[model samples]
Target chain A: MITGMDRLAAAIQGKKSDRIPVFCNLIDQGAKELGMPLKEYYSNGENVAEAQLKMRERFGYDNVWSLFYVGKEAELLGCKELIYAKDGPPNVADFVIKTHDDIHRLEVPDDISAHPAFQETLKCLRILKSEVGGKQAICAYVTASMTLPALLMGMDRWMELFMLGPASVRDELLEKCSDFFRKEITAYRNAGADVCVYANAFGSTDFVPMRLFRELSLPQMEKDLKPVGIDGVVYYCGGARMNAVLEQVIDRLGIGAYYLSPLDNISEGKKIIGNRALTCGVINDIMLIGWTMQEVRDEVRRMLDAGMPGGKFLFGTLVMPYNIPEENIRAMLETAYEYGACVEEATS
Target chain B: MLEDVITAYNEAVFDTDRERALKVIHDAVDRGVSPEDVVFKVVIPAIEQMIKSISESFDANLAQHFMTSQIAAEVTEEMLARFRKAPEVVGHIVIGTAQGDLHSLGKRIVIGCLKSLMIDVTDLGVNVPPEKFVDEAVARNAQVIGISAMMVHTARGENGCIMVRELLRKRGLEDRIKIIVGGAPYRYDLELYKTVGADASADDGITAGRVIAGLIKEVRR
Candidate 1:
């Protein structure tokens, strides 16, 4: 009997799994399902882990990763004003780096162990490892370094820096972020995280040019992930038509898994990712929100048909929308189970 | 001289040379290029040409797109400041990201697009409340209210455009001001715009400007 963890590990290693593992980005939806306030669930680690586990169990999925707000780490690192909302994660209300002098003053946290967000995330990882480590894979999430300048400085300023400043200025910011993430990844590893998932929205083709995405983001990601001694890392660059970047990242980064957005063409994505790294998304979030259950099932079947022929596929969404219907989610998993198993049988 | 300025500024923007780009504009103005002519003829055309070049190439990335637009916007702002006279406002518009959606890359790009077209825009900044949209539109007598919601969660329900639409109707400004939405969510489903009660939606910033401009024309006519 193959455990869910075993199936995910197998899929990541480019081996034939018992079936295609279903990866649901169910952070907000998990809180809503458990009838917990978004504020409460996001404030503490135990609640975050508990909500994620419940979501995984309900869906019979292969993994449950921590999906906290992207700004938690930034907030801990002295971004003063954070907007906590009832519907979503906290965001930076004000930026700290208002001038060139501020960038020079900013440094990686002196003690990563003492950061409240770090402590909370470690607690979440420990709880997941102790409770569900036997059956489900436990991954920990961190905002990628390339995406953090906007948190320290407002996004408009960050975009201006890219437009106006020398590449060195942008690199200095990324380097500081990289150092912080290195320590964060190490902390998560020490806490027994099975994989380190890096969410680099800025690294996506939607935000950065290919030259910068390749020249800046890829090298910074390599530096961040190289220290993580976990079995694999999940790199998510959120946007469509990123295969050009994805192809380079897969070749350069040592990560064993990739979360290509639903906006991406999955077949071409699969070809870019190849068998070395497991590809884990294709179903656009809008479809899950607006499509009927039958349409959801059909979409899942189509993704599976395209990806399941190869051994390196896991089913997931781009960004799981809040309050997605339980039935549509169930429909996606069922389609994956039924058709994904057929591919499994043939490969085995 | 204008063509030389545009070509030189284009190279500066392409090379990410902000100083040179600014110098080119300033020098052109020193040679008696009116500020408006500099904006309408040189700055806007240079940025538009850059955007067109990027779109033609499959390898163009986000940096080129953002950098080109940012230069155009900055140049427009600089010249407008120097001139000390606001160009005749072709149309008044208000724009922002809806409440809880902090993503502003799309909104900023749209701002550049609108400014380049000589639209008088008052940006309310990110995380704008629904009532604020109506309040500002009414106060400014704006022709359009542009709302951006990047994430699906933000795009749906009260957190995003839907709230703005409902408030617009309640304030009786729904018919007076056209609502246009753009972002990742709307790019996939234009019907989502209809559900949110937006008059129109565009996937890209340039198209959003064109769509909003057309809708404004329809309204004033």
Candidate 2:
């Protein structure tokens, strides 16, 4: 029997699989499913790991991607104002860098692995590796470099820097952000992750226009990601043109797979991505939560029909909504497995 | 002269030349360009051009957009200071992103729209508490309070839109102050308005401004 990891690896490498591996960029949904308060789940690695595994089992997810939230790496770097709430991921409470001069004092710890949040994430990866290991692909997550800076400075201030700051200042920040992410990717790879998923939400044309994405977001991402020898996937949300951006990242930057949002047409995305990389998704997170099970099943069948004919497709969601029902999630998975099954390649 | 200033402002901002953009605005004002005309004819057009380009799929780079917004914001402040009587206020509104949500790109865009429409807008900034929104609206005697929550948790969380609605009622100002909720969360489901007890919701700034105008009238009547 081919394991889920084998199937996913095969799909990513442009080989055939027996079925489309169905999972999601599921993190907080795990806590929501287990009825665990997000505050409790995010506070410790063991708790987060257990909740994720339980969610996978309950939802029949083929693979497990573990992440705490968007700003964990920043929190680890001595950002003091981390906000912990009742049932959602913690936010960077107050900005660490308030002025342009503060950029000079920014430092990356020599021993990143020693930071408590980093340690907790590694602990979660280790737990998942020990528990699921070869059976499920243990994917590690990191926020993309272009966006990680906003974790230290707020998003508005970061946008101000990108918009109004000097080119030298912007480049310096990009270099620092990329370097920190390099440390994060290295830590995740060293800790036994099967794949490292880099999230670049700002790269989407929805926020930063395509020109800035190409000039600022892309180069920084390529510089940071090119050194990582581990298999990598990208997550981006934007308008329809995002498919073209995904192609550049895969072809130019060497990412192996992409998790797309609903804004891009999957059929067009598959055509653009072709055999170069694996593609996993096109669901609107809002629809995942707001739509009924029947609506979920119908959309699942439609997406499966559109993408499963070719290789390198996985059934997934853009982002899982926090309040999404287990029944709706189960409906998505059931429909995918039933409708998304592919022909198994003959073994030697 | 208005056309010349608009073109100069457009090219200056698009080129990301903040100094040149500010110089043109000051020069315009020095040359007998009323502050209101500079706003309506030059600055507003420049910002509108950027927004139009973005919608048309032209790559109006992020920096240029922010730079143009900053110029427009500064000009709006100047216009309010110099000519409060020129453009009659359409309505008074208090706006901000909800508590626990620090993202403000959406709120800023909406603020720009409201300011351009000559509505008196007082921004409460990001991570604003629900009661703070009510208190600000009451202080300003504003007819509308527009709250933004971009993500799921912030849109529906305990201290989010739900909290804002209950707080407004608790303060006995629910009927007087209409709520217009927006951002990514409400764009997908207008039903969120009913859930959050907002009088209206809009997906974009122009629609938001128009909707808030109508909402103000409904509240006053």
Find the candidate with the highest DockQ and give its number.
Answer: 1
lDDT of each: 0.75, 0.75
lDDT of 2 by residue, A171-257 (tens): 787788788888887777778777776766676765665666777777777787777653655555432236757666776677667
TM-scores of chain A across candidates: 0.91, 0.92
lDDT of 2 by residue, B1-221 (tens): 98898898888877767788889989988999998788878876666676566667675544555566666777778776898586767789999988888878767766766676678899999889988988889999999998888777888887877887898888788889988888777866668778777788876654566678788888878
Q: How well does each candidate reproduce the native contacts, as fnat?
A: 0.64, 0.45
Provide DockQ values for all models, in the order shown: 0.55, 0.46
lDDT of 1 by residue, B117-219 (tens): 7888899988888889888999999989999887666677575778878887777776689999988888776688888788898767755667777888877
TM values, all candidates: 0.90, 0.90
Ten contiguous residues minimizing lDDT sum, candidate 2 chain B? B59-68
Error of 1 at B29 (Å): 5.1
lDDT, candidate 1, equals 0.75
Residue-level lDDT tens digits of model 1 in A98-130: 887788888788667678657777788878888
TM-score, A chain, model 2: 0.92
